[model samples]
Target: MGNFIMGKGSRPFVMENQMLMRHGLITGATGTGKTVTLKVLAENLSEQGIQVFLADVKGDLSSLAEPLENNPDIQARLETLGVKDFVPRSYPVTLWDVYGEKGIPVRTSIAEMGPLLLSRLLGLNDTQSGIMDIAFRVADEQGWLLLDLDDLKAMLGYLSENAATFRSQYGNIAPASVGAILRSILSLEEQDGDLLIGEPALHVADLLQKPGEEGMIHILQSQKLYLKPALYSTLLLWMLSELYEELPEVGNIDKPKIVFVFDEAHLLFDDMSKALTDKIEQIIRLIRSKGVGIFFVTQSPMDIPESVLGQLGNKIQHALRAYTPKELKDVRAIAQTFRESEGLDVAEAITSLQTGQAVVSPLDPDGTPMPADIAMIYPPKSKIGTLAEERYGELMRQSPFLFKYEQRVNRESAYEMLSTRAEQLAREQEAEALRVQLEKEAKEKAKKEAKNSPRSNREGITERFTKNIAGTVGREVGRTLIRGILGSFKR
Candidate 1:
């Protein structure tokens, strides 16, 4: 019960106004109960009719898919908070795992994914990332579609093999750039990138769907995927890009299509190149119109990119380890972010927070940062943590997603065409080698026969002799030229 006091009756705190769900962040050290806090907010928001997209990196939050249980502690919290008639409700939810272990297969076409995001996934440096961008551009121009990793590899191979040809049309591609980018792709492939490259890329609609009267919650299984930080980050950013691209502008709706919570968010921004960082900033800046909100979950407020950090209007700070000077400094920084109530000692409160308690600072209407309050977060009504593996699978098989991405499709994508062409070219080379081999064998056989039987050359030489009967005059010219030169010298 150390951190589990933020309940309904503990304090008066506004969780979030659905209208201001532009973007937000939930950050604290491990054991500070970020997951529980996220659950409380998501459940409350979903109850208020907002869709939620939760990336459960630890895979412990799948219980959101199940109905909430009745518990005395929950009832006590609600009663203490002066609230009555609290009912446990389950939100509509779909489980998503990039590895396809838990949910319907979510895939994105390589063309739609494009190179900008893939570059980050591959961890390409500036030069290599540029080369990748060029590859995507070239694919677009040639009417080639990239549907998977193989297609991308083939496109790169084609470009490298035909550098001169591509140079004439799309400018020069240096061998060095191509090599670096290819190496990055290989590194990605070694991580079993096949999971990332396939049809049925996650649909924004799937994330947004809320059947019947219940609000939808999307739970992404991110434990294994998080091991590849680059891929993990890129996958999230790509989904955001897809949402931005796919969803129409809805201005300020009552609720967003989905609330995207990026736990362990520092991985997304840390070690990213400037171009990739800039694109993230752009997407974060522009995605609000698409009716989605992004919440960064990390250890410290500093984990967020400043560009992105500046945009998060809501802040929920739990306890921090303020032993070191640097950490204490972070605590001070966290305190200053909120509008202070005189004598509230926000920094002191941050260091003193228990497991379930947080120094809450949600934005009010008019975009103004509200004063910090020591607020008690409510407990989730659902069973927390993993459901049975068999149960997860059963849900997917019987899911109502009939027309969604079940089909393993083969389009005129880069993979098929390049593989086909490679096979064809290999066959052509083999055929040519066979023809040469046959001709060489014939020549050897003819020579062997000629040596063994003199008649074999006699008939052939006589025929050659008959054709060259006029060839004797051609040799006489050489003799005439020498004689003329000698005669001139004597004269």
Candidate 2:
């Protein structure tokens, strides 16, 4: 799929497969063939047997699985480029979705997402983020695995209820902050964040699968996901982080083991916290050693940070509209990035470049910068637009995870564990109350018996006294009578 596109002033233009691991960028205004270039690169990389993972924000890349439709313009371009052996064909593809509507559900554990990313996903404030971190810490200490949004929610509730105890060890977890975090999480759930956080989490190995000569193309269906920009960006970043953390170091390989294309790449940085932005920059700078290449697709180069832009060795810049002064300035800055060529006025060329044309600068065989050239991007052999919903379903049915990821696995995580603990605690409190009540009743009955026994003892004492007095009086009278008779006789 990666052959010579055209002769650039008698020099053949090509994207060397070996230097692809160095990473790349694709920038252009809307309707300027950015999606087409992305498709071309994806198809070619897959042809080279390199696994490809890309987020299809507009659902445009889904058609890569279908044969390119015949178009007169495509034929003319092929003829103009003097390509005789060009055969339109489809590549192997697998579809995935967080929502489970368009493809196999792709999910990850809440712990895998971690508090930092989750905070970004939920758009939590600093205090709320701090509370979230505490919640995760509490969950970890309690041996509770957070596998879903509900798990995090339950953990937050648990922490709020036991805030006093947690404060001693973890720090103050304000109920207001906890509530804010919970509300944020609830908001995310309303946005279908529940579908993204779960068990049987996506295995990184699944993405590295190359079934045949052509690597498998895993396209994340992101039409609905794109609505939540934070979630969308965080999802891709987490995937990148996972790949970086999990994959063994394979420094400077012949080619990339996997290629990740982040479309609408600006969303990953917009409103992104400084710490997170630095983290992302660091990942982009270092993950190349893992034999993974990241391509950022966006509207303009300004959307990318300077630190990130410096690392992108290969640049494919599509057309830009310079209606405003700032846009023209941006165009000039973009033009200056290319290596100087004799008569190639990059600024002018950028505004006038036709659709399917781009200013490309890929690395050479010796890891040297190839002089930038204006080249007509080779048309993708696969379909250029979205596949029908029925067609999309048909392809999904053939995926390896047809039934595996379809049914969500709700393993006992923080949610169920905390819920069970709460129920158990309530039962224990109830039992304790019952025991106390029983003990109180026993004490009251014993007191009543003791009080009655005292009265009975008094009654017995009085009766015995009366009896003794009567007996003594009678005996004394008899004795007295006897004594009186004796005394009278004696007298």
Candidate 3:
């Protein structure tokens, strides 16, 4: 495994391949070479045959598929850094988009996302979140699949209608909570969050590059997605969770199987619940054993929660402008995160860092955090910005996943199953109602016919009068016979 040079400090600052899975952070102000550092790491990892996944939030990272052309400024920097073996090259790239407009549509089923993450995505309160959990459990117990937004909506509707039925088993499912969840679903749909969930769901295995082939850099087109911060962060986290769950425990491998770069990462923690934050912290702490590495890229170190920030072994800080007292205080705190280097004031160094310069602390060869160094970031071997439209289209057409995930599959999931069950129940109720109505009508008809029958009433009166006359005559004859019989008996 070859070590990729990040830049020259006092000596060449190299990122060891074995330490890539230790996780890292890249923080800087806007336009302070965070993107460049990200590109460099991704390109180098790909060259070493490790798959990479990163979000192209600003549409800048998509050009990894295009080779960098000769630029005078880049050449001068390369000379200044005394780079011996730098080549302009492009890496294998697969483009994905939730919107399906920019690239291959990436999707995941609601079941795969589960309740906790889905609740976070929906911004649900504790009550509503509990209802969501019940909804999933109900779906699962009833053998219903929660595949898409429609499935979830159907499930929630059923829960609302049958809250009393489920209350005994799954606890109270407040109608208001269900209503809140429904409204949140509607709001998400309005934001096109529906596009993120469905069939032909993304397989975590597909994110890995095929053996004996160059590592593929999967870039999610996130410009539109970033607008909906909750969705954007949740989608990324869902992907990470999948990786952590699916990949086998390959503890401390030579290199990571995949490296994930999370851009605009502050959005992930902002307004996040403590429970979820702890979950994320745990994931970051333990996911290295799964041969996966995560790098968080953001504007400032303060944007990250301290719990998560501490998990990153490799640290890279680009410039932060500290004019205000608060900004200066933040810069100092950011500096404190790194191990102090001799003769370098990190706080002062951070504020005055040039556009391509950053203070880096990559892990040492024996898996130790190195002291901070002020180093110039190397420009990407690939093109630095968005690819040309035609080239991008061609690449999209050539993607193997395009055909696999292009069309959505909507099989009989919760929506269809619940809807069918409801229809059947309605039919049965209708049939029972009709039977009751028919029986009542038959009884009423019989009563009315009996009341209107004159022939029957006349027959009844004639029979009674005839019987009465016969009875009186027969009684006199019988009395005489009985008296004679009694005299005979006495004698």
Candidate 4:
């Protein structure tokens, strides 16, 4: 394992590879070098064969695939920090997109996402969320696979239509709640969120680099995704949850199996339900044992909940603005989060520190928080901005997993199954209706024939009496002749 130098203070600032799994936080105002710090950490981790996953909201982090070009300012900073042997190079990068426009498409099935995360993404109220849970339970019991937006939509439609049938087993499912959830689904679809739920789901193992190779940096292209705050946060949270569930426990490993960098970290907690907030807090607390480190990159520490904020062992505080009274108070609170140094007034340094300089507090080798130091951050070895369009295209073509997730797959799931059932029911109903119509037509034809036939007239009473008298006389005459003949033969 290799320890990377962060930058220079009174002494060299370094991040121990073994302590990377302890988790960390990087906070500052916009343009205060948060992105640069992210890039630097990614480069070092990749060099150490540690996989990294981060979102590129501004479309700039794609430059990790391109080598750094000549920059005088970077060279000067390296010399000032007494840094030697800094090579400009690129790392392995896999690009992903939810919309499938910029890179390989990434998707997860609706069932795999489960009801809770889907509810969060849809911004559902408690009643609506309960309906969603019932919908999922019904789908599971019926052996229907919820694989995409269409599947979920069909499930909701079925629930609405047959609420009474399901109510007995799953409880009362209100039509209004179902409608609200459907409307929420529609709203999500309008935002191109439909693309995020489907087949060919992303496997976390695919995010890891192969053995005896440099670690791969999986960058999610979030330029448009970030526009939808709820979706962006929920997607990242789902990926994190998946990692925690999938990875094996390796307590206190020399290095993390993977490092997750969540940018725009505040959006994750915005309007989050208390239950969800507690779940997230628990994941952060226990995920370290799974050899996964999560670093949250945001504008301010105050953006994070106090419970989560306390779990970060490494602290990187970039310069923050404090022009107003509220801002001053926030800065002070942010300053107090760090381990105090001997001479540095942490709060004053927070507002006065230049860009690319931050107060760093990484965990010591003994797993304890080290005192904060005002230090300069090292520049990334890769390019500082977005990758060129031509290079971006070339990299996409070269990606090994391109064909795997490029095409969307829609297997037989809840949507198709429900549709088939509905169609069959419709056909049977139509057949029964046709049978009934045919029977009625036959009866009407018989009645009409009887009314128009020659037997429509009635017989006269005299003719009916004469025919009855003639028939009786003929029978008596024949019986008398036969009796006389039999008596003569006997004599």
Clashing residue pairs in candidate 2 (N, C-alpha, C atoms within 3 angstroms)? none
Residue 196, candidate 4: Cα error in Å is 1.5
Candidate with the greatest TM-score versus the true structure = 3
TM-score of each: 0.83, 0.90, 0.91, 0.90
Model 4 lowest lDDT segment of ten? 482-491
Candidate 2 is scored at a TM of 0.90
Name the candidate, 2 or 4, with the larger lDDT value: 4
Query: Which portions of model 1 show Cα errors greater than 4 Å?
Result: 1-11, 70-76, 168-171, 419-491
For candidate 4, write residues 1-491 as lDDT tens digits: 55878888977788888888879999999989999999999988888889999999999899998889999999999999888988999888988989877788999889889898999999999988888899888888899999999999899989988988877887888877888888888899998888898879999888875434678899999999999998899889999999988888887678888999999999999999988899999999999898899999999988899999989889999999899999999888888878889999999999999999999999888888888899999889999998777776677788988989989898899989999998797777666655655665575567557545666335466855675586567556655654555444444
lDDT string, candidate 2, 358-429, tens digits: 887888877677777788877789997889889888998998877777887887887788788877876776
lDDT values of the candidates?
Answer: 0.74, 0.83, 0.87, 0.87
Comparison by TM-score, 3 against 4, better one = 3
lDDT of 1 by residue, 1-491 (tens): 00122343134666454534558878878998898888877777676666787787887787777766777876776665676655665566777777777776566767777777777777777767766877888888867888887788889888898889778766778888888877877887888677777776666776776775556777777878888887787778788888888989988765666778888889888788787788888888888888788888899989877778888888888888889998889889878888887668999999988877788777665567767887767777777667777877876776666347656566678767777887787777666655655665575566556555766456676665663564455445545654565454444
TM-score of 3: 0.91
lDDT of 4: 0.87
Q: What RMSD does each model have against the real structure?
A: 9.7, 14.4, 13.2, 13.6
TM-score winner between 1 and 2, please give it.
2
Worst 10 residues of 2 by lDDT: 1-10
In candidate 3, stretches whose alpha carbon ends up further than 4 angstroms from where it belongs are 211-213, 452-491
